[model samples]
Target: MLRTLYRALWWLAAPAAVTRLLLRSRQERGYREHIAERFGCTAGRPLDDHAPLIWVHAVSVGETRAAQPLIEALLQARPDARVLLTHMTPGGRATGEQIFGERVLRSYLPYDVPHAVRRFLRAWRPTLGLVMETEVWPTLIEECQRRGVPLVLTNARMSARSFRRASRFGAATREVFGGFSRVLAQSPADAERLLALGARNVTVLGNLKFDMNTPAEQVAQGHAWRAAFGARPVWVAASTREGEEEQVLQAFAALNVARALLILVPRHPQRFAEVAALVARHRLRCERRSSWAVDGAVAGTAEKLDEDVQVWLGDSMGELGAYYAAADIAFIGGSLLPFGGQNLIEACAVGVPVLIGPHVFNFTQATADAVAAGAVLQVQDAAELARTLQTLFSDKPQRTAMGAAAAAFAARHRGATARTVEVLLTLLP
Candidate 1:
């Protein structure tokens, strides 16, 4: 009865959804491309519905990247488990498609309406489902449970605010989480938070982000980057969140930005253009990596050749590994401002010293550990951040020592992929 009514509501709202999409079509052509690409609703061979698939859904590029190590593990562990990867955002879907390619079926998760969920389940007939991080779709969870599709929430975390909201409707939320077969969370605090949210049979599984295996290309690129500006000294303002790029620019100004190139990769790719515009507005020359084609392969040879270029805007998607290879000192963004810090694991994985600013509630444990290990330096403001960057530029030995500590910290946290795979395999018949 619930599913029946939910589908009806979806149908009624369909017109509005269509209209909104049409109005934004020009502005968001990639999204339209995504829907066309995903649904086969635009006239290609339809997505196969007969296979018994393993469905995994992630929110965006960040979560999807975090889930990559696990996805690779699952594919290796179960050769027979045909994967179905779904994402809510167009960019997420794009990243998913690029990463998994034809090995995984791609789709936009239907709106959380009951009929959509029912249609999705009935069509895919997945053997098991994995929702990464906090992708809790109550209706979808309930439907999967009712249909006997085993569900697991992996690498889960819940902020205090999210916990409080779930607690207020504890009974309802509990009912939702009860549908999950198990929850493998990132930390004890996360496990406790999920338990509070009525999530069932949760266990502490350290964050998979830390377990990421760096590609050899990344290592090679890092060496190349070091050859280019490694001695010249550079500090990367990586994964900067909105409003934080300007702050990074301000930091560059306090010292001598001319001497150091600020490599700012926006946490969200959509802001790539916006950040480029901001850099231009500040009257600074910028080089976009996505557009650059260098002569003779050299460390940032394509970009740094433009000596007037102040900000190297990493507008490209799916290239963090390469960018991390191209840095000396790194600042993980979303921390400088109030947006909760971006993950520091990737930077750490590359053996680059890390620096962060206030606000890292999302990664409470990892940040705390990084700070204590002397693997990552935490600063309070843009002024301090500038001074810190300047100091690192002047001090090579300290930078090298910090980089080693960062790599060690990253090494200690591996194996979450294997552990997660173990838990996932248990769900199989």
Candidate 2:
């Protein structure tokens, strides 16, 4: 009865959902391109019958990037298997294309209405399904189960805040979680929460982000960029959400380090222009990453900027590793307010000393573990963040030690991909 009502609500909201997508498309044109696919009107080349089709739903960029190692492992394990990647956001689809290229098929997953879900399932007929992170669709789960398709919630995490919210949904939440064939959690705390939510066959396989190996080319590019930066204390504010950037820019404006470069990378691509304008409003001289050129060619080896350029706006996509690699210190954003924290692990993986805000319930375990390892430091607000940055910039030895620890902390958390693949293959037909 609950599932029926949930389906009814989604059906009723379909018009609004379409309108929202159209509104978003004004900022990001890609959102408008795949409108039909979102409504389950996906018509593409027929699937290869001989090869097993594996469907993986990664809602956006973060999930899509985290699924990289697992997806690669799956293809390696089952050479003939065809991996079908589905996403709801254009950024995620673009990231999938940038990372996987021709390796995996990409499509926008339909909205969670019964008819759309049925059409999507019928079109793909995936032998197995893996939903990344915390996405739980009741109608889709029910449909997958009804079709006898084994669905797994891979790299699952449930923050306390999220748990409390899900708990409010009562049996409806449990029904969705319980529908998964298996729940591969990121940590013991996550596993415990999933169990409470009635998820069955749950296993703690760590985080796939830990298993992600930074692209070698990106690392080299970062090194080149750092060399170009030439002793300027470079710090990256990576994957910052809305409202957080204003605080960060204000902090950057107050920071005392002379000729220091602040690489501000907003989490969303649509906000690139807005962030640039924000930097301008601070009266800080800013040079955009996209505008950086080497001898008239754009996006090549970084050219040295004028000493007056206080902020380097990272407006490009798929080059986060390079940005982290180019930085002396990294601040993981999204934690300043109440949006939880962005991934600090990525910065740590690049061997950079990290700082985060007080709010990190989304990455509670990872933040705790990183802090325990001396790889990360927590600050209460923007003022403290600026103070910490000033102190860290002056203390080179402490920064070096923290960088080493960050690398070690990242190295210690590897192998989740292998474990995830092992479990996933067991469920494959």
Best by TM-score: 2
Q: Tell me the TM-score of each prediction against the true structure.
A: 0.90, 0.97
* Candidate 1 weakest lDDT stretch, 10 residues: 36-45
lDDT tens digits, residue span 273-337, model 1: 88999999889888887776633244455333455666778877777776777788899899989
lDDT against the true structure, each candidate: 0.79, 0.90
* Best model per lDDT: 2
What is the lDDT, from 0 to 100, of the residue 186 in candidate 1? 93
lDDT of 2 by residue, 169-193 (tens): 8888888889999999999999999
Q: What is the C-alpha local distance difference test score of candidate 1?
A: 0.79
RMSD of each: 3.3, 1.9
Off by over 4 Å in 1: 1-28, 34-51, 225-231, 256-258, 295-304
Model 2 spans > 4 angstroms off: 44-48, 294-301
